[model samples]
Target: MLLYCFTSARTGEVHESTARRASAREKTAKESDEDLEARVMAACYKVYKEDVPLFFFNIFTFFLPLASADYAFRDYSSAHKILDAAEAYNIDPLENNILEVIHFEDSIRDVPLFRPLSELQVTKSTGRSRGADVFRKEFASLGHRSGYTRNVTIRSCRRWALMQVDKNYSKTARMKFASYVSRDTHSKHYAHPLSEVEGLANYLGIESRNDHIQNRRGMGMHHNP
Candidate 1:
């Protein structure tokens, strides 16, 4: 994604290796904080004007982890807001739901920028506890936004999956596929079985080898590999 950003910023004329080397060279020259900030803001503004949907999706993905955590904690209000926004735009939110490909350019003709982040409160205390408290509050707000995006994605995926099975499968097959997709999305994406289900298993004294195996896989471990 970083490479994509870099290439886009440069208009894709430069080769990847050339771009990397150029970036490395530029890094050697110490940049003042103000200069760096100016460059970053300029690049962001350019992207915002040139490709608004990419900007929106980038922001959505940035908060996605926090959104997933919020959903896992049982919050649904944020997710509802995101779904409402997508519905208003008639967006499906699938991975391949590009505006050009899906012919949604007309739908988002007047789309607005995302809401600004909440202002951070000024704190007088320099103590660790005060810092931690502020950090926790800021993180909670971010998590709320993130949960919204995750829910939107999950709902979109669910709808798309259902449509896919309906068009291509027999009645019985459609039913089976719908049931499996729902359970999979609920367990893997929203509920997160490793955290929620494993804890439940521990409480019920039903923890098993399968749970351990899943935990390992979730951590990016693979027995075959």
Candidate 2:
């Protein structure tokens, strides 16, 4: 068997490339499972709860039926029975689940805009040792608002990951990110969009230790590529 190898041009690390490809494949597979579960749970939620066509299966699945004061979806056996009943009743699970889908979509759209780093006070309140932990808490707060739905895509979810590298991580992190993404223009998400960087700098209460405002905004710029 010939093992395929991919080499990263930046790092010249062949192993890292293979590991990344493997990780992507794993993530794709996991997403497929989530999609299926979302569909099935949506259908089950509809029958057990209301006739709402757009069904949103909460990330905390147990809460979906509880919202309707219905417990039919709670038991594994009962859930399977509901699926059979829906099929027997000739219910088009997808069409019948429209209301649920709509609500679910709405929840997805509520993902928070990136928080201003200056306004964040996770360290004072929680006594969390690391910035990553602080960011995780912030992300969790966002998740809770989305009803703990796992299907949502969030831009700021990884902000905590960046905070992990340095507790005092601020615009410097964005600059480093921009440089990293600039090297490979394909990864726009990894870097702060120009607007986000600007919005962050403008948030009222956030203190700026960096003397020059323009420097913070233009940290990644180089005279030449």
Q: Model 1, range 133-222, lDDT digits (tens) per residue?
A: 233344445545655322122233344445445446675675564444343443343333333235556777984435574455344222
Q: Roughly what TM-score does model 1 have, to 2 decimal places? A: 0.20
Worst 10 residues of 1 by lDDT: 119-128
Tens-place lDDT per residue, model 2, 1-225, is: 001111111110111112234334454665553343211211122232234431333343544333323222323234444445445767555634442212222221211111125522322222111232343455556556756544222223233233233244555564474234343442344444433233454686575444353355444422222
For model 1, the stretches where C-alpha displacement exceeds 4 angstroms are 1-34, 37-45, 49-137, 140-212, 217-225
Residue 209, candidate 1: alpha-carbon lDDT: 39
lDDT of 1 at 163: 42
Question: Candidate 1 — which pairs collide?
Answer: 67-146, 67-147
Among the numbered candidates, top lDDT falls to: 1
**Local distance difference test values of all predictions, in order:** 0.35, 0.33
lDDT of 2 at 37: 26
